[model samples]
Target: MAHVLVVEDDRPTAEAIASELRAHGYSVDTAGTGADALALAQAATPDALTLDRLLPDTDGLALLAKLREVGIHAPVLMVSALGDVDQRIAGLRAGGDDYLIKPFAPSELAVRIEVLLRRTRPEAETVLQIGRVRIDRIRREAQVAGEPVRLLQMEFKLLEFLMRHAGATVSRRMLFEQVWNYHFDPGANLINVHIARLRRKLDMPGEPSAIVTVKGEGYRFDAV
Candidate 1:
């Protein structure tokens, strides 16, 4: 299980966030102030963190800088009531991996954290296997049912990321950020075009496509 630290001053909000994360199988620790948050983080580094922009003791950006200065490199999701473009940009500039505005769904928060964790965790194995699809990282090759599949550089990267998180839903935003190194959503059909092409190459003649669209949400890569 992944460990997460949630720092928020509002008691009810903190509890709700913690509860949601625990339900998602994460080990959670909560702090109502920056001092306490720093102490907990220094004592035991967490895998991820959720930080509120306003705290009783310190500003979220300052706290984030402090954490980085102390060598706690956990991915942070900044939660705040401030939804201005500048505020959001500042949060991201301060080392936040993602940001969620107030009144957001707890489930969405969990999903964002999930993405953050996926991005930061190191893949120790050189090869990844999911059902019939497999990729050899060292060789930069992909195979399906033991048959070689020719892939371009971008296709290989997209496939590797999708396979790494098989059975989980990945939004276009997540894909753009992780696979294409895009911080802002392009709002274009670029991903759709690539996904369509990938399906053509990856799917067997009579078998269903391995990638399933999760209507209104994102895409999920089925194991088979």
Candidate 2:
């Protein structure tokens, strides 16, 4: 899965973008300031970045230059309220792969980041594997222990999301948003029912379920 760093000072906007990216299966890290963003980028380079054009401490262009100096050459999608042609050009000239004007749809932002990632990493993996399970994204197939596993459309999507986030806790709300495309929780056992069916198919007799429930929080997919 692709990893993206979101650098935006606006708390609500940052959270909204981060949530949207996470729902789309990209691991995301958020920073409210330039210093924090630089620190995060240095510690663990992201595949791409969604940088706010106007940060509180420094101009986005300056931060971009700093990142380059430190050898972090990830593509950047600059987000700004300045939608004027001149401002957009400046952002592009400053190493922004793309510029998104404010008031834009979060879905569109995700797509733009995806496009950037594609351009930079054309060979991104299409198949996902964890332990004995494997899934081909292009062929829409799943296997456990080298044997085929039949799955309905919805079940495949759920499994894909879980596999992409292997070893991480996935919230029920996240599953609902990403898998079911539902913005609000239905307040039902819809996810539980589907997951139970999936567990039965993927689990071998006398083996533990791959998906583990984290009481009061959500489910964690054990990589093992």
Candidate 3:
């Protein structure tokens, strides 16, 4: 579950993009105004961004410069109607990670985001960190604030699940299928009980809470 920052001025379009990303277990933060979009981009701590070319307050290219100036180097997939090669080159010069024309498939948007995430991930860092929590995939180790955590088999799988989807809400059904590999009845409440226990260890007021429950949905990793 990746955290995505979406900067689109149109509300309907923003909602559509957010919904599509959420369906695949991505946590998305959207802004309609360029000022707000820049602010959100600075705070989103995203693994990527979906930005529109035309913005209300400022052009998207300028915002891209602002993002780089502030040191937010997350991969970005720019949304533009400009099809000219020179315009695309300008976008790249402005620090856009990728560009897409308007009137494109929602599925295509998702694909581009994934490609950037895969390509931009550093090869030397197999271990991922979100704040103080760390996951060492090769060693099968998860540490909390630098301390070794002793987890049951199920807990390890649950951590792995959240780590894979670091930001998006993973519905109960998806969790059941992917993490448990058990698509049992919807009546099953095992996920909730385990989640509560994990919360006690991870997010008890003074500590950081890596897991966030998305109300009617399921859960997400919120490590900013």
lDDT of 1 by residue, 68-152 (tens): 9999999999999998889999999999989888977676688789878977876589999888888899999989989999998
Q: Say which candidate scores most in TM-score.
A: 1
Reference-based TM-score, model 3 = 0.54
The positional error of residue 36 in candidate 3, measured at the CA in angstroms, is 0.6
Clashing pairs in 2: none
How far residue 182's Cα lies from its native spot in candidate 2, in Å, is 33
For 94-205, candidate 2 gives per-residue lDDT tens digits of 8988887888768668766775887787757999899888999889999988999999999999998788666666767667766797746799999999999889878888
Give the better candidate number (1 or 2) by lDDT: 1
- The 10-residue segment with the lowest total lDDT in model 2: 165-174
lDDT of the candidates, in the order given: 0.89, 0.87, 0.78
lDDT of 3: 0.78
Count of backbone collisions in candidate 1: 0
User: Model 1: which ten-residue window has the lowest total lDDT?
Assistant: 164-173
Candidate 3: tens digits of C-alpha lDDT, residues 1-224 = 78998899888988988888887678999989789977787666789999888997899898888888988999999898886778888887788877777776565576567657877774576687876778787777878788877667788778766766676666675567566866354676789888987776666466557798877667888884
Model 1: colliding residue pairs: none
Scored against the true structure, residue 200 in model 1 reaches a CA lDDT of 82
